[model samples]
Target: MTPEDLQTALARALTLAESGLVAPGAADGPIDVVAPRRPENGDWSTTAALRAAAHPSGRKALAEHICDHLLTLPEVAAADTADPGFVNISLTPTARARAAIDAACALQPPRGPWSNAGSGPWSDAAVDPNVIGALQLRHAAACRERRRARAAGITTDEADSSTLDHPSEARLLNALAALPGAVDRSRRLRRAAPLVTGLSDVADAVEEWLSRCAVTPTIDEDITARHSARLVLVRAAIIVLAAGLRQLGAAAPERI
Candidate 1:
């Protein structure tokens, strides 16, 4: 589901909880959904429970109550409360898959509030240069890997016998899942989008994908489609990164 979708769902769920819990109007305050740093922590998390716990019912009961209400939503497959208050949300598998594919197809950056010339951390012009340099190095490494595979006389047209299975590929998906939060934060914080957090996530994921994958468009068609997917994801990364830089008054160079 999209950010707006999830946000709306959470709001509705909170509304459902208002009359039943210690929170008379628990849904009155602002709500936030977070992308966990750990992949297994769940697709997203919310502080709604903690927010409501400040009333009187306390954290545990509020967490459970909110989670129960959240579970009633169609988009959410599972909702569970972690200790003290955070409510972790897992979207239905189909929802997660659709979100990933949608992100890949769109591959566009959402507009951010801050610009490079603004008085913010991302105002520096050098960040993109560093990012571009790293991207160049990665591209060169990919070319070299392909060259070696070719020198050993590996055939381009052959298909892999194995199904899709790669750690880096899995990591890439996790990286994509984190992008919306990053974009929203960029806008909300009025900071650069390609800052250390989101941009680094994309870059590190891309770097890992490069090191782990063994296919090349210059030679072989990626039988598992993993390589193509990685390329798509990385392209989205660069597009968003560029948008962030440009908004921040930094020029995104065509070449590093």
Candidate 2:
């Protein structure tokens, strides 16, 4: 089944357990579903019923009910209630491959901006030169401080200088400072430029910041204009990660 489909089925089963229709603690079982260690067994397997049985009645019966429900799904070739109430499921190979492909495709480029395209507040409204200047100055000062500490031969366990010593950090700072100008230039050259080319470059800059600064992106409407600009940079970095996962034939969940 598709990831969404599997998730939905799991949710439904959990709900049944919570309502006491199944054995107590079934909802809290260690394994949601299990796959066979040996290929001869089946595509997937589960000991959820056995785990649930530790608590209460009709565990085997409840497992059979769950297996019956799973067997109704198109992707499931068959589902059996094994000895001691195990639910083993065999998936159709075509269904498995299709699910994988859909997941990979969902990770493809330009998943779109974090900004809502409909009527709402635009980020440009909050941009402030003064705040941007202050942030830049603060970063520059920190870099200078690290350099001075290194020059003075002040070595301490608390002060790990490897990152600060890297030239890539300097390049990232330069890129961050130039982002506004680069974005502006991209807008001006819209007619001659590729649709997402400049945006991709901005994404690269954000990735550099993430690798160096470890900042997470958020969608806060109340943030200052300067912080909002940094949020845009973070969004670009997320897009880069998504693109990379797509190229690698892997899927990144929307809410990882």
Candidate 3:
């Protein structure tokens, strides 16, 4: 799924939770996502509720507050909380597939049929025997490379690149409001620890999603045009992530 889509949904839920808090400002910040360490749990987990535990409204109250709102988002199949208040989110299978398309659109609008060509969503079918194997490695590598490029701000079609955003990792941004200046090392490090941890965690969650939906590519494989478009959608997710990290001062990692 386009992680940002999930992040946007979470952000709205957070907004709802914050509205009822004693200090709405305290609830403001990036909402980190991670693959659940325990398989039995939801697909993505965030500690927004836990972070807001210190709020005047109380931890359980704040936690449940966010949980209630998260449940309202269609993209979120399920929302649950852990002790001390962590909200775990599960995406419906359909939502997961749609997210892949959204990710593709964020990179560049779907071309071929999904665009101004023939029909909508999809108008054809394609098949391949190697639909679920090492091919995923190539997709992963390509995604990582594009991610690197975006991180460096290397410049793609401006319109295409501009469509991607990493609001989930907004905490990583060293915005003027967060610190005294860019050179304030000690303070920056202090405030940034969570952001770094959050990035790593969210990457894992996104990876898990990608791993689940691996398929054929557009160039080397003999897949149908419809499947090719699906790959494009998957590829866009890499750009989405890279663009976001760049905002946080990522040096454009040479490799994931």
Candidate 4:
């Protein structure tokens, strides 16, 4: 699931958990569900409960209650309390696969998520010839190349994230899932810098995955479900990056 999805779920859980303690509007702030810096922490974590708690003494209890509600979600596997008021969540592999496919499909024909139309979030911003802009263009080109390859049937099998066992695959999926939320957050704040940084993180994760896994194996026998799943992730990343770059008033050229 995307971070925004998780945030919405978390907010609902928090509201239910905070029933009598917090007033109706007290817990109406943005709920931030971010990828933990440390891998061992979990797929995503949030400290919104801490801020929502009426008193410091009840933070732990509120966190546990919210986690209890979060665990009810089918997409969620585990929701554990950490640091008294923080909740670390782990999504099911199937949910991850579904999320990646949803992202990829959202960019396909008809009306896609990323629009090249005039007057958008970044319409007022200037796209100068700076390093960040250059990097965004390069990544956009790479995404286009990858999407072209995917459309050519380099990955024919359906995406099955359950087959994804490599650490790189996990990291890539996690990064992909977080991109939409980051873009939304950036748009809400009316700033392109955070989205740019988030794109860099996704790029770094892609680089790491490429360094360790083969998206298109040379030998036919070596092609596996893991590779196909990775391709889905690549496609997802492509659309997300394209959407974010478009919002920044940048061009994702068909070729570099």
For this target, which candidate reaches the highest lDDT against the unseen true structure? 4
Model 3 segments beyond 4 Å from truth? 18-22, 108-137, 140-256
Q: State in Å the error of residue 51, model 1.
A: 1.1
TM-scores of the models, in the order given: 0.62, 0.39, 0.44, 0.79
- Model 4, position 248, has a per-residue lDDT of 64
Model 4 — which ten-residue stretch has the worst lDDT? 115-124
Best by TM-score: 4
Per-residue CA lDDT of model 4 for 22-69, tens digit only, reads: 435655787777778887777888987787887888788888888888
Q: In model 2, where do residues sit more than 4 Å from their true spots? A: 2-4, 14-21, 28-31, 53-57, 112-256
Against the true structure, what is every candidate's RMSD?
6.4, 19.7, 15.3, 3.5
**Candidate 1 ranges with C-alpha deviation above 4 Å:** 2-4, 18-25, 54-58, 104-132, 135-171, 177-181, 184-190, 193-196, 210-256
Candidate 3 C-alpha error for residue 108, in Å? 5.1
Higher-ranked by TM-score: 1 or 3: 1
Candidate 2 lDDT over residue span 121-238, tens digit each: 2223432334333333333333443344344433333322222222333233223222333334334553212212332333444345545652222334332333323333333334
Candidate 3 C-alpha lDDT tens digits along 1-256: 3344455666666566645452455445666766566655756677766665556347677767777887777766678877767777766544554554443343232431112222111122321223212223333554764454345343323223112223221211111112112113322353433333333433444454444433343345443433333334435444434432432333333343
| Cand. 2 Cα-lDDT | 0.43
Candidate 2 TM-score, C-alpha based: 0.39
Q: In each prediction, how many residue pairs overlap at the backbone (N, C-alpha, C within less than 3 A)?
A: 4, 1, 1, 0
Winner on lDDT between 1 and 3 is 1
